[model samples]
Target: MIERLSIIGVGLIGGSLARALRAVGQVGEVVGCGRSGPNLEKAVELGVIDRFTHDPGEAVVGADVVFLAVPLGAMRGALSAIKDRLDASAVITDGGSVKGSVVADAVAAFGKVPTRLVPGHPIAGTECSGVEASFAELYRNRRVILTPLSETEPDALSLVSRMWEACGAEVTTMSVGHHDEVLAATSHLPHMLAFGLVDALARMRENDEIFRYAAGGFRDFTRIASSSPVMWRDICIANREALSAMLARFGIEMTDLAESIRRADGDHLLEIFERAKAARDRYVDRVK
Candidate 1:
């Protein structure tokens, strides 16, 4: 159990983690730090955290663990703030969407990667983004991927793994580069597509009619368009290299599909649809 846990950026991710740990009696005290005073107060009022602070340095004073839940662009600032204040024995982890950028941020802030720092990303969330959107069960049945550096401590990795397990997450580890590439294709690209689709539709001359006549399929595919733009913007920029590669590949496929449709190639359309259906079916079955 963590005697004291410090959560930076106590919005959805951090607040949910604090609530999860407290729910299981795994944390003695949770200190939340964020920019908003009211949000911090609401976290305390909701009992997601035991206390609150605006200073990242102060929040980690006696914490046994520190969870960085800020956006990728803000990670360096937050890490720098608490770098010298963290307890020597405190284990640090994160819920950053991009592992590679986060590791770079830590290295830049600390002048070296700390062995106790475990860079992680949880493959879970709703299209919601505030303290009110947090829940103790957010990580339940979800996967949390940790990208630990070669110099990372074994005990630190184990401790972070156990904490996620306690939150009902299945923990796994991977190389930072591989994790970034995988997420760029799976998570980042999807979000970008959703946002771009919704934006393009909204800007059309028949936007009102299009939106009014939109069906469930459109809503389902673009649901992630409603997620926090600020956070997604940071993630896209942080993983731009891998994301750009994925986007280019997807664009090529889109061009091929468009050409097939223009040529009225029934076999090409049928084959592509069949492949997609089978892939989606396998994915859904595995998820279930």
Candidate 2:
């Protein structure tokens, strides 16, 4: 029942949400705001939103719902700018990958308005950004994680959940801490690995040769490496504690693999490879 919605940052997630919301008739009006004048103009031209602005305060002034889709590091700054002007009854949510930090920052910036804040992460994206990259089906069949604190109003939480559900997403509730921890393993760690592997390979003496000889496998493996550097950098720093734990666990498993390879333990290596293959196969089967 959100009559007026404002989407801040108008990047891949925000733009996609705007497009999906319109397609699903989830809101009466959708407005987009971002720091980039050209991007806001593009969003308006793309018909993703009814209007666009560069002012956060003006964007959320009368909105019934507001989504902060900026990078995690920019969350605080954006919230601070719009804090005073946001509708008291508006359900303020965000698309930030990291939740704990964002929740804390938003609460600190907005004071008692924390009750209106609902932290969420839509487990959907592409290696794309800006209004031009957005599609109405970007969130179709995707899982949307809603991290609502005890202080969060039930009506606000329900509104946010229903909005995402109408956008073709499956909504589920989770704690902000648990959401951050799980994402650190599933999404954040994989991105880090992709970035590191690509960087290490590109810096080698045979870098150009490797690129010339690369096939679909290598290309697919490094495809996410091309994602926005600023966004990934912010996510890495924002969730460093959880990411560090995941990295340490991965390192231990990697060390065991290396030890088996060094010892030429073919049987153990085969078992490990088989298990991994089976695990992936199981996931594929489930998806199908």
Candidate 3:
């Protein structure tokens, strides 16, 4: 069990982790660090953290484990703040979606990727934000991916693996490049498409009428568009190369679909639809 845990951003991800650890009685003291005083107070009131501070350095002074749960863009600043203050033996990990940028930030702050630093991403969360939206079950049965550098200590990786397991998440490891590419296709590109579709529809002349007649399909497909724009903007930029590749592939598929419709190729359209449906069905069965 972690004796002292420090979370550098007490929003959805960080607050949920704290809550999960508390529920499982795996962490001793949870200190939440954030720039927003009101949010920190709310986190304390909700029992998501034992205490909070605006200073990241102070929060990590005695922490046995530190979770940098801030946005992708804010990672460098958070890492810099706690760099000198982190205990020598402290295990440093993060919930940032993009591992390459996060590893770079850690190297910038610490002069190298410390053996104690392990880059991780928890594949969970709704279109929600802030302390109030967090819950203990957020990571339950969800996948947590770890992309540890070659310099990472085995003990550090094991500790982080166990920590996520204690939160009821299934942990897996992958290379940093592979993690970025997979997440770009599976997560980032979908969010981008959702946001772009919703935004395009909203700008149409008959937007009000269009939305008024919208159905469950539109609502479910665009649910992720409600996520924090700033966070997604940072993610898109951080993983731009991989996301661009995915977008190009998606554009090619869209062109093919459009051509099929123009040619009235019913068989081709049916083939595409059937393939997609079967892929989704297999995924659902695996999850079940």
Sorting all predicted structures by lDDT, with the top scorer first, yields 3, 1, 2
Candidate-wise lDDT, in order? 0.94, 0.90, 0.96
Per-prediction CA RMSD (Å): 0.6, 1.1, 0.7
Clashes of each: 0, 0, 0
Worst 10 residues of 3 by lDDT: 106-115
The number of residue pairs in model 3 that clash at the backbone is 0
lDDT of 1 by residue, 67-103 (tens): 9999888999999999999899999999999998998
Where in model 1 is the C-alpha error above 4 Å? none
TM-scores, one per candidate: 0.99, 0.97, 0.99
**lDDT-superior candidate, 1 or 2:** 1
lDDT of 3 by residue, 155-238 (tens): 999999999999999999999999999999999999999999999999999999999999999999999999999999999999
**TM-score: the better of candidates 2 and 3:** 3
Candidate 3 deviant stretches above 4 angstroms? none
How well does candidate 2 match the true structure, expressed as C-alpha RMSD?
1.1
Across 1-288, the per-residue lDDT of candidate 2 in tens digits comes to 579999998888998988898887777888888888888888888988888888898999899999999998899999998988987798899999999889878877977548888999999999988889999899899999999888989999999999998899999998888998999989999999999999998899999998899899988988899999999999999999999999999999999999999999999999999999999999999988
